[model samples]
Structures are given as structure tokens and as C-alpha cells.
Target chain A: MRVPEVLLDVRDLRICYETSRGCVKAVDGVSLEVYAGETFCLVGETGCGKSTLALAIPRLLPPNARILSGSILFKGVDLLRVSDSKLQELRGKEIAMIFQNPMTSLNPVHRVGFQVAEVPVTHFKMSWREALATAVRQLGRVGIADPDLRSRDYPHTFSGGMKQRSMIAMMTTCKPSLLIADEPTTALDVTIQAQILKLLHELKNEYGLTLLLITHNFGIVAEVCDRVGVMYAGKIVEVADVTEVFEAPLHPYTKGLIDCVVARRKSKSRLNQIPGTPPSLLNPPTGCRFHPRCAYVTHECVKEEPRLIEVRKNHLVACHNYEKVGGVSWSS
Target chain B: MELLVVEDLRKYFEFKKGLFARKQYVRAVDGVSFSVERGTTLGVVGESGSGKTTLGLTILRLIEPTSGRILFNGSDVTRLSKEELKHFRRSTGIVFQDPYSSLNPRMRVKEILERPLKIHSDEGEESRVERIIKTLEEVGLSAEHLMRYPHELSGGQQQRVAIARAIILKPLLVVLDEPTSSLDVSVQAQILNLLLDLQSRHELTYVFITHDLLTAKHVSDFIMVMYLGKVVEYSTVREVFSNPRHPYTASLLSSIPIPDPKLRGRKRVSVVGEPPSPLNPPKGCRYHPRCPYAIDTCELREPELLEHDKKHFVACHRAGELSFREFLADMDSFLSE
Candidate 1:
């Protein structure tokens, strides 16, 4: 099978928030790429800058957050340098994002159909009637039965799963080249979460859309992602194939995250838990953000930050002792 | 031996719709019954609005049960008077889902920990502080943390402080309402491990209420699956996981995503449609609307929870007839389509 072409490219992105407690380095020097039809996942714990990195792609960061450096290239156009009018034109047409909480993202007073069709009408200059028709079809595509009737109902009328499905329908109604889904299934139950993930995978294939899936659940990343990027303290520490990351995680943070998840198949004597909390973003540890909690921390790990170095064919790890870190090998 | 026995427990909240209109009864805990043995964890798993939290609260008599018997130590605490209930509350403590909200923001960790000890025991203030410090250590918090308020700590640290306060009273039964749900995965493991250690050390009984099956399976000796205010299935963790008798139980287990991508295409039972409202539940079985094998009998009469094995009890009319493997295979095809 031929690989899809790259659609969006992010280079050395840096984002900082001006808060009372000092400038919070939210997304610090992060870079990633999204292929035309591939699912590239950003996996990390909360406050690891996965969401910040995602929001930066569409230039949707709050007023307090400013992009200190870097370029976001979509079809060779730097999104960071684009004017507000141009960025607005590119938002729902070239890129769309699905937020974590669907309830809050949706307008409470407006009908579901109106909220969904707002983008198509505003961006594409389509008639209200024509946009509503398209929105109905989009709802049906996301597996909501009786879309025509349900579209007229309010957000409160729908259940959690239905709300999430409606959110997906609204996000993908324009058929943007890249879809950034930020923890879309975290608020849902296991069964509903499974259905949503399956739906997302189906939608990705049917629309031939590239995806940037953000989640804290490793299980979700393993299931949906083709390539995975593990972030820590606003930096991509490890990037590799899904199978490689799961089978042989290189970074200490990634390893600890994998260990923390309770696998359905693994029957262990005791669950392995990583000790200590993630460092604060305001004053993140000097050299390596993960050095404080890393089990194999060396003197060099504290003095200088490690860069992403190719360890194997397609695996990149940012650890000083990638060659010597012991335990379960990733070759299996 | 049964340390606490709940027989046909029910809690209903009556809402006055209008001045002269009829009232509406919200059946939060509808005729649920289960027993907890000494030194064991009974995990109650369900989705939101499934009455798992209300059941936990009702057992402790924090909220009075509409109708039922909560027999602890062979004494029916459900029927106890307000003053008498205080004695029962002393033996039972609750840790809520959100530690930040549950703990008072204004109070320091030391005050929160000492309140329970001061209320339940007649110990002097100086000795109580020492005991509070010891409890903090047990939950993996330090005495330095005692002076800090809930806002000063992270989510995990606040949860640890909550655990210290709950276990400081040495309650025989502790109702943990999603104790580790709000914390991060790594911190969740630490909290769960602490709970396990404390349970074994004190020989305490725990009613762990959560929607997370993996965590439930990790800590619980026995697992109970609830749907629309009903206990659909209750069994040993190993037996329930390996060979789920009830269709609902089987579907819940299969729905959980395993970390391995190779198993992504594995067969799983997927229950379609949302659970019916508790205000007007289904006629016979609450799960019949979502069950794959719902038949005429299932709609006509509710199946009583019967023991298929030594300790496994399932409440499905077609439990013996339905094959979980075949159902899962069918669901996989249906879902993929």
C-alpha cells in the first residue's frame, strides 16, 4: 500500500502562557507531522502539553498564550504567519478540532443542527437550508439514527455517547484534511468509548482524513494510532510506531505510563506504579523534565537536555541511557 | 462471616412537581441486596446515574433508606434513630470521589484528620495529633503535609489526605466512592495499593464504588455489576471475568480496551442503546432492553439472581442458554459492519 502524503507539518513550536505565577512554558519546542490518511497520536498524562500542542496547530490558544517561536505549515502555508481572515478561512476548511468535553463545546441554547451547520455556512458561504441538509447527512454518517429529527433537539436531550457522536459529526462536517481529536473518549464509559473509537477509525478510513488523536490512555493510543508521540513537560520525548512504543517503550516517562495502565491480559503479582508526580510547568526541572522521576537518571541527564536520537529504524528516544536501560526488551 | 448484610435495600427521593400535582419518585437504590464478609472488597461497578453512589451512601445511613435493613454486626442500622445512627456512623466512614470537593478548603490537613478522631474517640488533643501524623504516614503522606491546606497540594496528595482522614477513625467498613477515579493513572495505582495495604493491616471491609472495571478487578475480591439501580450480576472477580454468566457482565468486560493493539480486532459483546431511565425502568428486567438475548420471558418476568456456580450469581433468564463467545463474535461482526 502506498503511504499517504504529509498534509500538516509543525516545526520547533514553542508556546508560553503569561500567568501571575510567571510564564508557564506550556508547549516548549515541539514538532510533529500529520500524513494525509494516517492516525498520529499524541499520548501523555494531563498537563503534559499534548492539548496545548494540538491547540497550537490551529492557532486556537487563549489570549494569554502566545507562540514564542516555530512554524505550523499546512500545504506549505505557515499558519502562524497567516492573517486572521486567512486563518479563519483555513480553520474549518483545512483543519478541524474535536474538544474533550462535548457538552461545553456545544452551544446550549442553539439546536444541534444549527451548531453543526454554523461552520459550513460561515466558511463555505452555503445557504442555511443547504448547510442543514449537509449537517443531517453528517449526523447519519456518525451513526446517529433519525438524524433529521434528532438534529432539531437541544444538547441536553442527547445522552453522553450521542453528544460525543454529534460533536464528531460537527467537527468533520467540512471534511477537513486534518482532524485533531483531543481526548474525545475520556469522559465516556468503556463500552461507549469503544464504540466512539471504532466510529473514529471508521470515519478516518471512509473520509480518508489524517488524524491527530490526543489521549492519556495508552490502550486507546495502541488501538487507533499508526505512529505515536509521547510528550512530557511540553516536549516530545519519544516517537515511534504504535507496536514499537507498546512492545519496547524507550523513554522513562513512556515506560512508566505503560506500566501504570492495568492491562486486561496481564495477570501480574503487583501492578507497577511510577513514584512521584509530574514536574510543574512553571519551573520544570532544569535539564531533563523526567530526570527527577526517572529510575535510571545519570549525572548527564540532569546537566543537559537530551535530543531526539534515532535508536532503531523508526524509533526515536530522548534519553541519555537508551542503550543501557534494562528490563523488558522491546524486540518482542 | 457476614460483617454487613443488606437485605432488599431501597432508597427513593420524592420530588414535588407542582403545588397540587402528583409527586415523582426517583428510585435511586431499588431493592438491592448484598453482603460483605470480613476483610474483603466488594466492587460495585456501573455507569453514571446507576445508583452505585446512592447505594454506598444509603448503606452508611448518610442518607436514610426508604425501605430496607442494613444489618451491621447483627444489628439493623437502617432502622436506627437519628441519635442511635451516630453510633453506627462512627463505625463506618466514607471517602468521596472528588477529594478536593469533599475536603474543606479552609481547614488544614491536620484539622481534617483530627476531626474524625476527636468526634469518635475521647482522646486528648495532643495524643490525637500524634495519631493523625501516624495515619498520614500510613497513607504515604508526611507530617509536613499536615500543616498545608487542600489547595496547597496536588490532586494525588489531596486524595492521600482524604484516605488518611477516613482510615484514621479505624472504621470497620469504609465506603470508597471512586476513590482513585479523579487522580492520574500512576497516582491511582499508588492510592489503590495504599487502600489494599490498609485493608489487610486492619482487616477492614471495603465497598469500592467505581465505573472502572480494571481497578475494580485489581482491588476487589468479589465484583458486582449494577444497571439502572439493580444488581445484575455478583461473583468472585476471577470467575466473573473468566466466565461471565450475565449478558450485561460479559458486554461490560469485552467493552474495555486492552493495551495490546493485536487484540483490537478481538470479539467483544457490544450492547447497543443507552440504559433506560430509572424513573420509569423497563417492566421486567432493567437490562433486557440492552441484552442481546432478550426474549419473551425476559420481557414478561424478571429473573431472580441464581447461583450458577458456588458463589457466582447472575440474573438473566437465558443465562444458561446464551453462549457468551458466540454473542461476542456476532457483536464484533455487527460493530465492524
Candidate 2:
């Protein structure tokens, strides 16, 4: 398969929030690229700053979050330096986002059809009548039953699955080049989650849209993503092809996460849990953020941070003891 | 011997539409029956509106059940007086899904643990404090954590504190409603292991309620699958996984995504359409609308749960004729190889 052209290029992205205690380094020095028609997944635990890095790509951070340094270049235009009006034009047209919670993100007072039509009417300058028709078509496209009748209903009338489909329809109606889905199926049940995931896969192929999926569920990453980046303490500790990362995870943190999940899944006995918790972002460890809980931790691990080094053609690892810690190879 | 027995449990909430209007009853948990043996786990699996939580709550009498018999150690506590009910509740505790919200935000961990002991027993405060510290240690928290509030702890630690409180009273049964659903996988493992260890140590019977099939399989000795406030299937964990009788159970097990990437594109039965509303369930078999093997007779009569084998019960009329063994064999092949 030929690699699609790179549509969004993020380099050295750093974001910090001004808190009373100190400056919380939410996203620190993250760099990656999303190809034109591929799914790039950011997999990590809660509070790992994957969401913050995603928000930084679209310049959607709040007023208090300072982008300390870095550049988000999308289609040759630096999103950090774009004018407010130009950014507004690019938001819904060039890039669209689907948030974690669809209920809160959707406008409660408006009808579902009008809320979905809001994006196309505002961005493409389509008339209300035209946008309404387009919105109904998009709803039907997402496998929503009786779109015409249901479109007139409010968000409360729709089930969790339908509301999610509406959210997806709203995000994709404009046919944006890239879609950012941050935990889109977290609020849904397994059955509904499967449906939504299948819908996203079909839509991505149908529309030829690049996808940036941020989720903590590794199972989802394995199913949907082409390439995966494992984040820890606001940094991309490992980045590789989806199969390679799952099969041959190199970083200690990635290995721990995989082991933790795999162990719990296989044994009817007690799960082999990873000791300790994720470090606080406000005062991260001196060197590697994962060094505190790493089983193969060494003095060097605490003294010098490991740079992401290519261990294979496409696999990267950011651990000092990657070559030596060899009881169980992640790559089966 | 039956450690906990619930027969024909029903909990309905009445809503009035107008000042002079008739009342509308929301049948949250309508006529559910099951029993748990001593030192065993009975898992209740269902969808969001399937009333699994309401059933657990009703069993504990946290909310009054409209009519039922909750026999704990051969004593029916449903009709107990307020004083007797308070005493009965101390012997049967509950752990909620969200640990952060369940624990009082303003109270320290120590106080949270001690409040239960203070209410139920006449033990001195000093001894209760020691018991609290010991229980905290058992759940993997330290005495240092005693001074921390719920906000200061991580999700896992707060859940541990919640478990410590539930077990401090030495309850005969603990009703865990999706206890680990809100937690990360690693933290979920820790909490689950803790629960198992505590169960063995205390010889406690547990009614674990969750929609997660994997967790249910790992924790429960017996599993009951519910749909639209009805028990569709009930059997041993091994039997349910190896030979699921009901169509709903088969669909649910197949819907769960195995963590392994090698088994990604395997073929399995996937149930289509969402669950029907409980307010107005379908005629006859509530599951016939989605059942792939539905016959005309299914829509005309509801199937009663019958004993297909010793300790295995199924409610589908065609469950005996269905080839559940073939389905399990296919799933095992996909998962294993």
C-alpha cells in the first residue's frame, strides 16, 4: 500500500497550563505526522496528555493553556501563526473534531438536524434549506434509521448510539480532510461501540479522510489504527506501526501496558498489575517519566532521558534497557 | 447451603403526570430470582437499562422493594423494622461503580472508614481506628493515606478505600455494581485481585454486577445473563463461556473484542439493533425481535427458565435445539489459534 501524502505535521509541540501550584506541563515536545488517508492513534492512560496534544494540533486550547513552543503545520500552513479568521475557516473545513462526550458537546436546545446543519451552513455558506437536506443525507449515511423523522427530534430523544451517529455526521458533513476523535466510543456500550467503530472505519474509507484517534483502550487501537503512538507523561515514548507496536513493543512503559492488559485477559487467576501510578505532570521525575515504575530501571534511567531511537525499520523505543531486558519479547 | 436467596424481587417507582392524574409505574426490577452459595461469586450481566443496578440495590433493600423475599442466612430481611433493617444492612454491604463520587469528598479516608464501624457496632473508637488502619492495609493502602481526602487519591486508591469501608463490617455478601468499570485496565486488575483475595480471606459471598463479560468470567463462579429486566440464562461460569444456551448470551460474548490483534477479523455472531425499552417490552419473548433463530411460536409465548442440566438454566424455547456448542468451538478456535 502506498503511503498517502502527509496532511498534518506537528513538531516539538509544547503546552503548559498556569495553575496555582505551578505550571502543569500538559503536552511536552511531541512530534508526529498524520497521513492523508490513514488512521493515527494516540494510545495512553488517563492524564497522559494525548487529548491536550490533539487540542494543540487544532489550536483549540483554552485561554490559560500556553503553547510554550512548537509548530503545528497543517497542509503547509502553520496553525500556530494563522489569523483568527483564517483559523476559523480552517477549523470546520480543513479539520473537524468529535469530542469524548457527545451529549455535552451537542447543543441541547436545538433540534438534532439543525445542530448538524450548523457546521455546513457556517463554513460552506450553504443556505439553511440546502444544509438541512445535506445533514439528513449525512445522518442516513451514518446508518441512522428514519433520518427525516428523527432529525426533527432533540438530542434527548436519541439513544446513546444515535446521538454518537449524529455527532459523527455533524463532524463529517463538510468532508474535512482530517477528523480528530477523542474517545468517541468511551461512553457507549460494547455493542454500540462496535457499531460506531465500524461506522468510523467505513466513513474513513468512503470519504478518504485522515483520522487522529485518541483513546486509552488498546483493543480499539489494535482494531482501527494503522500506526500507533504510545504516550506517557506528555511525551511519545514509542511510535511504530500498529502490528509492530502490539507484536514487538520496545519501550518499558509500552511493555508494561501490554503485559498488564494481556495478563488480565488470559488468566482466570489474579492479574499481574503494574506497580505504582502515573507520575504527576506538575512535578514529573527528573529523567524518564516512567523510570519510577519501570522494572528494569537503572541509575542511568533516572539520570538521562532516553531519546526515541529506531530499533527496527519502523519501530522506535525510548528505554535504556530495551536490548537487555529480554525475558519475554513483545513481538511474538 | 444458600447464603443469600432472592425470590420474586420487584422494585417499581411511581410517577404522577398531573395533580389529578393516575400514577405510572416504572418496573425497574420486575420479578427476578436467584440464589448464591457460601463463598462464591454470582455475576449479573446486562445492558445499561437492564436494571442490574436496581436489582442489586433492591436486594440490599437500599431502596424499598415493592414485593420480594430477601433471605440472608435463612432469614427474610425484607419486612424487617427500621432498627432491624439497619442491623440487617450492616451484614450486607455495597460498593458502587464510581469511587470518587461514593466516598465523601470532605471526609478524610480514616473518617470514611470509621463511620461504618461507628454506626453499626459498640466497639471503642480506638479499636475501630486500628481496624480501619488494618483494613486499609489489606486493600493496599497505607496509614499515610488515612489523612488524604477522596480528591487527593487516585481512582484506584479511592476504590480501595471504598472496598475497605464495605468489608470493615465483615458483611456476609458484598454487592459490587460495576466496581471496576470506571477504572483503567491496570488499576482494574489491582482492584479485582484485591476483591478476590478479600473474598477468600473472609469467605464472603459476592453479587458482582457488570456489563463486562471478561471481568464477569474472571470473578464469578456462577453467571446470570439478564435482558430487559429478566434472567435469560443462568449457569456456571465455565459452562456459560463454553456452552452459552441463550441467543442473547451468545451475542454478548461475541461482541466483546479480544485484546489480541491476531483475532481481529474472526467471524462471530453479532447482535443487531439496540435493546428494546423496558417501559413497553415486546409481546411474548422479549428477545424474539433480535433473536436470529426466532420462530412464530416465540412471539406467541414467553419461555420460562428451565433446568437444561444440573446447575444450568436457560429461558429460550429453542435453546435445547440450538447448537451453542458449535458456536463456542468456533470462538475458541479463533481465540486460541
* lDDT, candidates in the order shown: 0.85, 0.86
Write down the lDDT that model 1 would get. Answer: 0.85
Interface RMSD of each: 5.9, 3.2
User: Where is model 1 more than 4 Å wrong at Cα?
Assistant: A1-4, A264-269, A326-332, B325-337
**What's the CA error at residue A113 for candidate 1, in Å?**
1.3
Candidate 1 chain A, run of 10 with poorest lDDT? A262-271
DockQ each candidate and list the results: 0.47, 0.46
Docking class of 1: acceptable
TM per prediction: 0.96, 0.96
RMSD of 2: 2.2
A150: Cα error in model 1, Å = 1.4
In model 1, how large is the Cα lDDT of residue B11?
93
lDDT by residue for model 2 (B1-337), tens: 8999999888888888799998887778877889999999999998888889999998888888999898988888787888888888798889999999999999999999989898998999889888988999999998899899999999999999999999999999999999999998778878888999999999999999998887888788899998888899999987888888898898887777665566667556667778777777888888998788899989999999899989889999998888666655645732221
Model 1 over residues B1-337: C-alpha lDDT tens digits? 9999999999998987699988998888888989999888999998887899999999998888999899998999967787777778778878998999999999999999888887778999899989988998998988899899999999999998888877787889999999988888788877887888898889989999999887787788888999888888898887777777888888887877667666677777878877777888888888888877789888889889888889888898887876676544533321121
The local lDDT score (0 to 100) that residue A301 gets in candidate 2 is: 92
- Strongest candidate by DockQ: 1
